[model samples]
Target chain A: MPLVDRVLLGPGPCNPYPEATLALAAPLLGHLDPEFLRILDETCDRLRTVWGTTNRRTLPLSGTGSIGMEAAFVNTVRPGTVVVVGVNGLFGVRMCEVASRYGAEVVRVDHEWGAPIDIRRMLDAHPKPDLVAAVHAETSTGVLSDIGGLAQAVHARDDNALVIADCVTSIAGMPLHIDEWGVDIAYAGTQKCLGVAPGLAPFTFSERAWARRVERPSTWYLDLGLIGDYVSGGAGGGRTYHHTAPTAMIASLHAGLGRILEEGLPAVHARHQAAGAQLQDGLAELGLKLFAADGHRLPQLTTVWVPEGVDSATIRTRLLRDFDIEIGAGAGEYATRVWRIGLMGPNATPARPALILAALRSLLG
Target chain B: MPLVDRVLLGPGPCNPYPEATLALAAPLLGHLDPEFLRILDETCDRLRTVWGTTNRRTLPLSGTGSIGMEAAFVNTVRPGTVVVVGVNGLFGVRMCEVASRYGAEVVRVDHEWGAPIDIRRMLDAHPKPDLVAAVHAETSTGVLSDIGGLAQAVHARDDNALVIADCVTSIAGMPLHIDEWGVDIAYAGTQKCLGVAPGLAPFTFSERAWARRVERPSTWYLDLGLIGDYVSGGAGGGRTYHHTAPTAMIASLHAGLGRILEEGLPAVHARHQAAGAQLQDGLAELGLKLFAADGHRLPQLTTVWVPEGVDSATIRTRLLRDFDIEIGAGAGEYATRVWRIGLMGPNATPARPALILAALRSLLG
Candidate 1:
């Protein structure tokens, strides 16, 4: 199956670590078994280290990133809960959508597609939003918002309002200091900077955030409190069955987390930065303009303007079919205007940028 | 990883086909890539066949089986929806819990843990109920409900009430005629008789069931209608983004489905039957009593009464740590009274019974 031999340079789901894939092939273990419980403990420890937090209330949700996004709100947001969701791209918009489903009255703070959200405006708009959520990195637009400042702004308005950040693209890619950033809750996917295949969503909630819950979460499956009790050990330190966890996927994530820590989170972040600079230089040499603003652009996911009069889809098809390479077509306002190239995870290397650039130049020129 | 060197005899997650694990090592693909879209088409078509339904609404939810169970109700049950749920095991109780989260007015029909639900009473108790839900196979007690008869009985009382089923342990293990049985909605996990790793939830819904929706499914992540539109190709046969699907998990499932089709459904069911009978014969020879009612037990999962004064947990731990074998602990009313020996998936073999029996005999004899 690996013989498909395509270079993945997409918005997310950058190529996973080879070790991660091998870990996936490892024999399955029952979720409640002692061996798996040990693995779960190690996985959670590694997650905490990379997240730059010591929060004990952390574990991977048994769904993909979107459900992880849902977990943050579904477990905290109740009917009549006022949520201030900042919208910069598709994922930000999705937060409002998911929150409203749980009966939250969402006040959306709209920002430009390729720009970081306006923190001051967001705090001013919703003085006492129950949950203030913003994407730490918008994969759709390749824009990275300043979560530290956002969290500070949120608490300045309402001391009890929880600050939630979507770190689907930013974790292990760039610096994300959860405790230092004052983020009360955050959720991230394994596919991006963690160099693991996409299946589980690693999430954490601060003690302050956990204490503020009004009622039991509406949903049963995604209830963090119930799941926490099961994972942190049921009453008297024994696990109660939560759900049949995706064993192989979790194993892959565990191995991926191990590699991240081995490399050190700061070093992984640095590699992504260097790779981003390499792609930026290559694109500039090709006479292409970067889509996101210079200062706020994400180092892992780079966006470039589609040359005028060139069909974006045609280039993508040719890249995949002929060159065995994959790049992402844009979404929303930028759908026809840009192409996103990812240098996340194991794909975050200068060689990847060089190869993709050569393929693109041959096709475009 | 399979070199952990243990034979799995759990209720579900029975030894997956080796090919499924290999497929997981395949290189990553973008969720919206053309190649993946083609793969998605093939996977859905294969699932439809296994489910014995022509319903185009079939697809694998991107989470574990519990979400699949949630999908049936979340998509249809609205606030104040009347739901008649029959309980005989832990999974039945799970159905009641999940359905209630969707605001369903659940009328729980209780039954003995090891006996089939009283269908006549269930139908008569909730006359004209909006929905009738039952478990086809109770993994906790190893009783297989007569779904075809139950479907007829539910319709006899309320023609409009949708008949839903938890086919987690039933699908592919034994005969299941979805369309012929008139089951409006059915859901299953991959790790069961399907012989795939645990991650994806393969599910199906009838045309009549699909047509009865009032408001959109309460939750977004498990919303089948939106996911169906995306998988079926959005407006104008164009695919749209839903959730970032777990590429490796889906690939593993695709390969698992291929193995099932190659074996052919009836032969697969027959294999399970043979394995079940062998285990039954061995258990009877050991002078152990089966827990479920005569002529009503599931072939895939066999429940046996634990000998008086034998610590079940100690035996389970010894079987795993000493003999490199894993079976299941009992649940609910049956807890401390029985052990669930699974013959599901590829592990359902006459040889498997012989191995487990010898180990049990050596332990007890």
Candidate 2:
């Protein structure tokens, strides 16, 4: 099959910013090239700014958001470490699975799949836990949890407990203040609101998180301490070689971040807000009921219940085949009942929502 | 820190093929898109051909070569499992570190850095080791080890023993027969000989290796079983969601592999051999001593001793600044004594070496 143009309105990998798309084709650079190193440093600076942190340990990991999830846990959750995870969606559920892989004594605070995380329940689950984790924007359900509120509650109870936030789908699309929210560790995907392709994970670690990092993580590839040393060269001003940095992906990310910051982060967030509002309001006009809980729905991703008497897969296939628009189907039990439509990064525009809404209207009719 | 085009004559990422570079700019595709899936399947098929393997579990991992090294061991080496590692260079040293982290009882078969692995010594390291491993090409020292001979020796001793090979710097540039040599597990990088920018690791596992895979690997991101399910799908003909695949990097890899296959693998390897020979002869004519052992030096990466009284870093800097050419300086103790140059993929041509040699001559004079 030949490559075809796609209007990616699925959970992520929405159309990247034009600058990022172009940057991918740029000539290859060696990982240790001085020019590439400068680009890398500048890229990390942009990440810190976007994450709303002054963290010195900020750079893109070589893998995607899922690796980010793995690194966050593998570096902090030693054997028998107590971890409280707010499970509101698939990602939250994944946090428990990943945390437990590193022998974390995971305390699951369960909530409805489409509902925002219950902070009170999360706080009450484990006293003086080593880590508390929550997905700021649950991509699976299109629900947005309050990371700031969760952090405030957790820190109030146990100041030493680290707060790790999954900002994979929220960064650059929503209001996020990693430092101010007391989020000790945060990880994000580039393909979502950052308007880049899916390869690199934008990761950060606060001073407290860094100080408390595992001396030697089980997984060598995702070891944050080694990666941090390589990414942010030590006080001696030389990068310790870890792995071959994905140069092209980092270049694209640098370009993508440049596009976002150039447009101004707040303006980027506003655009996504407008696009999501447009999509949700249009879906309502088409007689579709939203799936996520009211008032806590994510602005970048909107989940809607599949109307009764409609074949979900057929409509989705038609939208993709006939309209070149791709929307996401719900996972697990909600597979046939819910649809996830995203308006992220470059795709988060009034025109995109209008185009997708019209495509849906035609297909449903 | 403006982006400037430099002739990447470094150890790896030696200037991507134009086709691969162009493919990176292709429009975004959802990870689950049918077109992308077809492309991915074809890409894996190409990888099997390049790897000389019939392994059903062949696909690109969403990380670099080092992650490939990590995954190969993390999936097989359980606690107290006796594993024999041939440590001649940095990557081999890395394998022992990575394997030991997963609780493997590592037995190191030490070899000189600039020489090929001693297969006899490696076999003698452990009589009944569960896994025997060696690097096919040492990127740091530019030495090529005989993985086929090592596999034959190890399997002769114990057929149940898994033989893992690090083909990171050897894959498309040198002769590799994964199946024919009975290599149970092997992994490679894209940036070296594949003519693609770094990101994905082309990985493969034999039937025996897959059968003995760790049921619950500690690292979720590098879990081959979960990734295999998603890449190859199942008997039900549906791909399970593992993680978001790096679409653009994979596309670039697909294109790079296509370019190589189109040119013919033998032709590509011959080109690399010819270019390397030319560079080595030119360096010898310049009165520089070759570092790697005779007849074992890689036909893609050439390491030579920096001439006496000639500063390695100063010469490298001059080449980059004056001629826009980037070559690698040796790591660790050899940092000031040796220079590593690569003619890989698109840069594996006579003209590239000729240009670099002329630039070096001027600087040395």
Candidate 3:
């Protein structure tokens, strides 16, 4: 079979780092191999530094980004616990569903799509909430919420309330200091800003919030407390068998994280901001309107309203088939009315944005 | 870090096909990429062929073998349902734990370790069991139970009972006819016989078993009802987003399954049987005894009793460190009494058995 040479500039899963490719092909090892265990510990330390936390319970959840989000609720929110969640986009709505499925009394704070969430409205709900959750980067609308302000409000109302954020699309591309921002739990997917394939998700839990978890998590595959014990040296300094860790993906993430640290987080953030602005400007030049609110948009993912004369879905298909480029069409209410183009991780390069702009110009004409 | 050049003679994670490694490094596509959707369809087709059933509900689980097990129960066994589980080995014991965690009233049929389950006894005492589950190839004891007979008895007692099997260590290396054998649901891990890495798990559910599921599964991550719809081209012939599919691992499984079909399942089964006999005979000559019951033992994984004089754990450590070979040490009751050796997939070769025997001879003598 011939290899597909199309570029990935969609919502996520942009081309992984070249070193990640090497890590994927590295010789296989037993999950319990001493060498592999050492790799796990080292990887955890690096993830800690990247997550900007000293929390020891930090580790990668075994499944995808959604599972990592599920882990946050299943492990922390017990039955009958009141959770206040912001429902502005698809992701915020997903958080409510996940929390409610876990038996939480979800209190939703609604906002218009493509607009920033109102932290004050979310925090001023009746019946004091135990958890306040929102998406740090709402990928669906390309809007960024104020996590620090939400955290401050949650604590002011009740120091016991936990603040949770989904940093899946923002980690390496934005300024996110999890600890300083008071995010009790935050999960990031590897496919977004980390330049890795979409599998393992790095999620961390704060010391105070996790102390409330006395019962085992409902989902056996995603039992964070047990997985944490196994990943960090197990009982009696020996690693107990948890689920078989996805060795190839974990190794790939280790390699990807190393590249992230070497380039440095501050520099990576600057590159994303610059590249995002250039693409947004180019879209404006083509008479396309940006969908996200002006003052609080995610730089890494830009959503643009479909112009009146063009068939939006047709343009997306033509870009992929003819130009060998892929961009995302908006979902839910924004479907067929807007297009989401991502400039994340390696795709945030100045040259790549130019290529996308040129391809758009050629195809639109 | 230098790669370890050790031969995996342990119970699982045997050497994978070189082609699988190359496929892992293949250029990644977006989860919804047209090329990748084609790959997903192609992979589902190959999996259906390899699994020996025309069931359209078959696909690889994104997590490991254990999550596949979790999915089997979570999808079929509703809370408060009665399930009869056969507990002849560790894997069977685990089936009971997973079922009970999902709130099933699990009635366990106990058998001594290293023995096949008594099917008559298992079916005779049950208040109309909703599900009857057992291990096809128990990794811990190297015991192969009679899944066909168990399925027959399960249906004879009550046609409503779903016959579930754990074929984690037996899939491509054994005579597993899911439809003919009456298994409503069964899951297999990639690392064992499929010769892929240790991430993806391929499992299937019968139409009846899935139709019995009406309520949404508690786990958002392992919800088969939703994930199945997403994989089989969701409503209106467009795939709905469920979670980020593990593209690299899925691709590697696709490549590995292709190799399995090219070689044919019968040839793979025969190779494993022959190599297992060779390893058993060599161990017997070296003054050891096979632990599993005669005539019912698994050919890929052979559990052996440690000789009276030599320390079992010490020998395994030496085999790994000195001879670059890894073997399994028993847990629980057989902790220091047995060693489990594997000859599955790539490790089930003519020359590899000789190497393991030679390593044992040198280390022991």
Candidate 4:
């Protein structure tokens, strides 16, 4: 099949900003070229602004957001280390799986899939744990949790414990203050709120987290320490050679971040918020029921229960085949029962939701 | 620093094919879109042709070539599994490090830095080992070893033992026959000879190797079993959502492979060979000495020793700043003693080397 134009309105990879799309076609640069390194440095500086952190180790990992999750645990989690994970959606469950593989004693605080994390329950699950983890924006359920509140509570309970946040779907679409929230480690994807193609993971590590890192991570490629030397570089240290970076992907991400900052972070967040509200209101007007908890619902990703007697897969196929639109099916058990509609990045506008709503209304009628 | 165009004559990441560069700007596609999946499948098929393998599990991994190295060991090496690694250059030494990190009892067969791997020495180093590994093209040293001979000899010693080859720099620039030579596992990079950007790793696993894979590896991201399900799908099964793939990078790789196949594989290899010979002859005429062992030097990358009292870094800088040309410095101990001149992919022509030779005559004088 040949490539076709797509309106990516699913969970992620929304149509990128025009500048970001064009950046991918820029001529190749040697990974170690001085000019390319300058671009890399500037790119990292931009990453810090959107991530809302002063972390010196902030840079983009070569793989997607999932690799970011792996790097987080592999760098710090060691044998018999106690990790408390808040499990409200698919991403939280993945954290448990990844942490355990690195010999972490995982304590999971399970909640309903479509509900926001219960912070009190998570803190009470395992006191004095080495690390506490939660997702700020759960893509699977389209629920947003209070990461800042969770971090404060965890630090109050055990000040030594590190806090890790999965901000894959929240960085640019929402107001995230990693430093103010006391987040020790965080990982995000470029596909969603960043308005770029999915390839690199925007990752960061605080000084405290870096100080307590494991001496040797099991996976060499995802080792944060080695990658940091090449990407962000240490104080008074020159950049070291690691793996060949995906130069074109990084350039595109740099352009995407530039677009977000040009629009202003708060304004970008406001746009996403307005688009989500429009989408939610329109879904209700169409007689559709929202799946996530009412107050904690995310604006960028709106999950709605499949209407009664309506075939979910058939509607999705028609959406793609007839309308050239792409939305995501719910994960795991909710696959057929729920639909996730995204208004992220460049797609975060009132008009985008209107197009989807009109198409849905026509197809259902 | 404003994205200046350059002639990338580096060891890897030579200028990408025009088609591949344009493909990166193509509109984004959801990873699971049927059309996108079809393109991915075709990309994998193209990978098989270049890798010279018919393995059912062949696919492009999300990360670069180094990630491919990590996946190879993390999937197969169990605690105390005996792995014999032939160490001649940087990548081979890296394989030992990765395998050991995965708890393999690694036995090293050390060779000179610029010499090809001795298959007899590698097999003799560890009798009855679970796996035997070597670099087919040592990118750091610009030397090529006979993986087919190594595989045959390793099989003769122990039929059940897997034979692994690091073909990162050999796939499109040289003659590689994985199945024809009984190689059980192989991994390659897209940056060098594939005429693509450095983001994806072309990887394959033979049935025999897959049968003996460890049940649960230390990494969740690089797990072949999980990745294969989404990329190549099992018999009568559909692609299960693993993680969001780098769609743009995959599309670019697909277009790159298309260009290579269109030109014919043999023609591509011959071009690289001719370019290397021309460069080597020109360097000799200019009183320069080649670094790699005679009869084993890689045709895609020609390593030449820096003349006594000559500064390596200064020459490289001048080439980049004044001529807009980029070349790689040697790795590790030979970092300042050798210069690697690559004639790869779109840059594999006699004219490319001639330009570099003229530049060198002016600068060195």
lDDT (Cα, tens digit) per residue for candidate 4, span A1-365: 46689899999988899889998999888899887888788899999999888899999999999999999999999999999999999999999999999999999999999888898898888768999999999999999999999999988777899999999999899998899999999999999989999999999999999999987899999887788889877555877788999998888898899899999999999999999999999999999999999999999999999999999999999999999999999988999999999999999988899999999999987
> Residues B1-365, candidate 4, lDDT per residue (tens digit)?
36699898889888999989988999889999999999999999999998888899999999999999998999999999999999999999999999999999999999999999898788778769999999999999999998899999888777989999999999899988889899998999999999899999999999998899987888999888888889988555888888899999999999999999999999999999999999999999999999999999998999999999999999999999889999999999999999999999999987799999999999998
Between candidates 2 and 4, which one is better according to DockQ? Answer: 2
Whole-structure CA lDDT of model 3:
0.85
Candidate 1 error regions (>4 Å) = A1-3, B1-3
lDDT of 1 by residue, A1-365 (tens): 33476788998788889889888888887776778778888999998988889998888898888888888888788888899989999999999989998889999999889999998889888667788999999999999898999898777767878989999999889887899889999999988888888889999899998788645665678877678777897657766777888888888898998888898888888999999999998899999999998899888999999998999999999999998888888978788889999998998887999999999899999
Clashes of each: 3, 0, 0, 0
Quote the lDDT for B231 in model 4: 93
Task: Name the best candidate (by DockQ).
Answer: 2
On a 0 to 1 DockQ scale, where is model 2? 0.88
User: How far does residue B296 in candidate 4 sit from its true spot (Å)?
Assistant: 0.6
If both were scored by TM-score, which would come out higher, candidate 2 or candidate 3? 2
Pairs of colliding residues, candidate 3: none
Off by over 4 Å in 4: A234-236
Give the per-residue Cα lDDT of candidate 4 at A102: 95
Q: Please identify model 3 stretches exceeding 4 Å from their true place.
A: none
Give a tens-digit lDDT track for model 2, residues A1-365. 46799999999888899999889988778899888898999999999999999999888999999989998998898899999999888898899999998899999999989999888898888778999999999999999998999998888888989999999999999988999989999999999999899999999988899889998999899888788778887668778888999999999999999999999998999999999999999999999999999999987999999999998999999988898899999977898999999999998888999998899888787
How high is the lDDT of residue B28 in model 3? Answer: 88
CA RMSD of each candidate after superposition: 1.4, 0.9, 1.5, 1.0
